[model samples]
Target: MTMRRTDVVIVGGGLIGAWTAFFLARRGRKVVLVEKGVVGAQSSGTNFGNLRLQGRFPGQYPLSLRAQALWEDIEELIGDRCEFDPSGHLYIAFNDAEREKLEKYAAVSESHGLAIEHLGAADLARRYPWLSGKAVAATFSPRDATANPRLVTPAVARAAKALGVEVVEQCTVMQARREAAGFVLETADGRSFGCDHLVNAAGAWAGEIAQMFGEGAPLFPAGPPQFVTEPFPYFIRPSVQAVDGTVIFRQIPRGNVILAGYPRTAADPIRNRAPVPPAKTLAAMRHLTAVVPALRDCHVIRVWSGIEGYLPDMIPVIGPSMTTDGLFHAFGFCGHGFQIGPGVGLCLSEMICDGSTETPLDPFSIARFRGAVAEDEKFRREFDLPAAAR
Candidate 1:
């Protein structure tokens, strides 16, 4: 088949790319959604599905709130159920230092218009007696929830196809450069595609593409390991996390739990090998037992992993490619983009289709890091985990 052209070509068909396709196609733009692997086969299909608003940075909370509302009605928008849960979040705190951080977070959260309640250890123990005695305090935000990432991702891709988006799978974009008319993209398969604009949503591998532009930034990639338990009676509601802050476990409707945390060896960025390790799995399981003893008896059924993009700042990069015209990037989600995918798609579509984005996209732009903004650098220090997570 002879290669064709389109108004836009999204170079990654994960939820961010797929949902962007959904919005653009709805606006009458011819869209080509290309993926290196199957659609949503990376971070979109893996990782913990915590659709949360709590713990977001001050400048980021409002956007997260907007995304949360969009997620509430995503089923109606996409004509497919996203399996969004609304059981809220509990930020566990183990000791004075961590508790102090949560206390500061709670204040910052309130100032930003989010409703989070501070709870002492006794209160936390009374509310959910299953929490291990190690948890000294907690901050509860009633708006967070967990969903099925594996299911929601493929569903979003199908929804985009239904909306007239041409999704191409297993098509690797070997090289991309600017053209006067648009962006010229040639695939590893010896096919060519032209687009009025380009969006780089290739999770983990986005840096590989960004480096092509000669851009330098602290873009770290990691294939974090995680696991899930065999279905059992549902003893947990919402997500149960430890105050010790080592583990995060969320249960699905099927009564199975998802796990992610510090590892014996954090996967290197360049190599970026992805597969849940048994050591990380066991660590998460042990941490889960310490947080909620009830989970100790549940047998784990599967362990898996995916490489996620991160900037030292911990916020996503959502704006246009500064040096390249007809190019935009939407990687480096830092593991939080899934909950905000709908809003991100809408934001990117507005920018790509209309040439201007509505939200406060300035906060996530790559240009900020290069200049004196340095917010990303500060965030990296504040949210630093131990070597296990690094």
Candidate 2:
């Protein structure tokens, strides 16, 4: 076997992995990134690119705030093109319950430094006359934005390459182990690499890698169904989501409306493909059409799904592995990893290179789930463990 050596080895090529590699390489670290397939080929590449702080979990607000700043300066810092649009975000409330929920969330979000403008039915109508009459109230975040997922991972990888980061694509790590020198990994194609630090950013397959080191996290694979309509007149300006979260849709500059809302379908990590059911697609269209009546007459162009890692608590497992020194993990973003990908990467790089990040990551530690086997067993009674691959 051919042996190679590096200062750091990243075991995933998603946005977090790619951004981590870019940050490390820019800091003059010798980094090697390994991907089973193309970078961003999975969830990172296939997600709805809405970057909003409106509906984030409270624990994530701090990082989300910092991430929003990073997104504003991404192109200048990374030297890669991200088709980012600062089109803001509009969250609609169709009824009294949803209106109350939106109002409450907006108040709490304001405390976190994210100012959300509460919009009444008249205000919503005055601002967005094209919206369907179902909107009773809304919240607007002017700092919220969108980006092209198809452009992020590859761009980050390219920028890292410019800084001399080694990218090994189409290589599957068959075996990995800790050694005195650090971590050693062997791929299926007779290749070997060793590094002093190992970062497990493997997305949906991250649980298996964590288990390789005796760290058990109940990470599950979720494949959300998404579809886009054929080109039409662009009317929707901001990426919109219902307060109930039953639907989310955004109109791109090219006039295609990308949308998703159905339940997450299960996907096999090895194959990395999940079939989108026709029935679910139809249901999603119906839900979207109800909000934007113009979509009722639009032609469906394409439908698809991608695998994402979801933890039981819906928070990410990011920070040092409990059982291993010099090993870190940054995966399991549930279904909302894209918006925080850059923040997670920056924090991980800081923790590794600078011993800590200014942003708080203590809440995302792996220790929270450590020695929780009994909890897992109990939780399994409600939701099967086979579905929770961790």
Candidate 3:
């Protein structure tokens, strides 16, 4: 059996793992990133790619804002733009309830230093004439953006490789255990890796790794169904979503309108499948047309989904493991991992190299699940929580 040693072994090649490897390598730490499949072939590459700031969990603003700054300067950091666009994000309200939600969200966002523009019905109609008349009010966050999820993980992996990090693809870690010296990971292909520190960024499959170390979380696997329409004349400039959470869409410069549906589809981690239901597709189409009347006739070209980990609380685990030493975790992103990938990587690197980070991560600690994790209100609304969590 071939055996190798490194300063850090990151099990998972998704965005968080790839970015962590890049940052760790930049800090002169010998790192090896292992993936069961090709890099970014999972949720990291399949998400809707919204870098939204207007409606995020208030506690995540610091990390999310830091991540947006990294994305804005992506070319300087990774030498690739990954089709990132700061075209803004528009949240529209269809009724009084949704308008109130938007107002609360905008206030919280403003408190976090995010600039928000509130638009009344007339202003929304005048500014976005293509919008349907059903939109009663709207909020626009100019700094929120979108990017090509299909391109981000691989590009970041390449950057990490360029910085002397070893990226091992299609190699699954069959066994991982703590040893006297550090942590030892055995791969499916009869290879062994020894590292002083271990990082579990394995996306939906990270729960298995955490369980192996005596820390288990109610991590459910699921994904949002996504679809893309055939190219049309470019018109919509920013990513847009209804405050009621039925649909979200954006028109790329190439004129293809990509959208994601709500009430996430169930995913099977063992089978590696996240199928987009045909009924969901039709419902999403109707919702999209209701938001933007111009898309009523656009033919959908393709549909897809990827597996992502969801916690009952709708937040992620992003700190040192409570059960073991020299171990860290950053998984269960619920479907919002793309924008904060870079910031998560940077924070993980700081925790490993300097033993702490300035960003507030106490809310994401693994110890929070020691008893019963109270399900977040959004989690109950957005996901069909597993019976175990309920």
The C-alpha TM-scores of every prediction are 0.92, 0.94, 0.98
Cα lDDT tens digits for candidate 2, 1-390: 767999999999999999899989878899999998989999999998888888777778889888888889988977754889999999999999989988888887898988788899899879888888899999999999999998988998998999999999999888888998889999999899999899999998888788889987877777788889999998888999987666899999899999985566667776767778787788888889888887799988898888888777777888998899999999988777899988888888888899888888887888888655233221233222364354
Question: Model 3, stretches more than 4 Å misplaced?
Answer: 384-390
| Separate clash counts for every candidate | 1, 0, 0
TM-score of 1: 0.92
Q: Give one digit per residue, the lDDT tens place, for model 3 in 78-177.
A: 9999999999999999899999999999999999899999999999889999998999999999999999999999999999999999999989998999
TM-score of 3: 0.98
Give the CA lDDT, 0 to 100, for residue 351 in model 3.
95
lDDT of 3 at 233: 98
Report lDDT (Cα) of residue 334, candidate 2: 78
Q: For residue 272, what is the lDDT in candidate 3?
A: 94
Per-model CA lDDT versus the true structure: 0.78, 0.85, 0.93
Model 2 RMSD, rounded to 1 decimal: 3.0
Ranking by lDDT: 3, 2, 1
Looking at model 3, residue 34 earns an lDDT score of: 97
Residue 55, model 2: lDDT of 74
Clashes of 1: 1
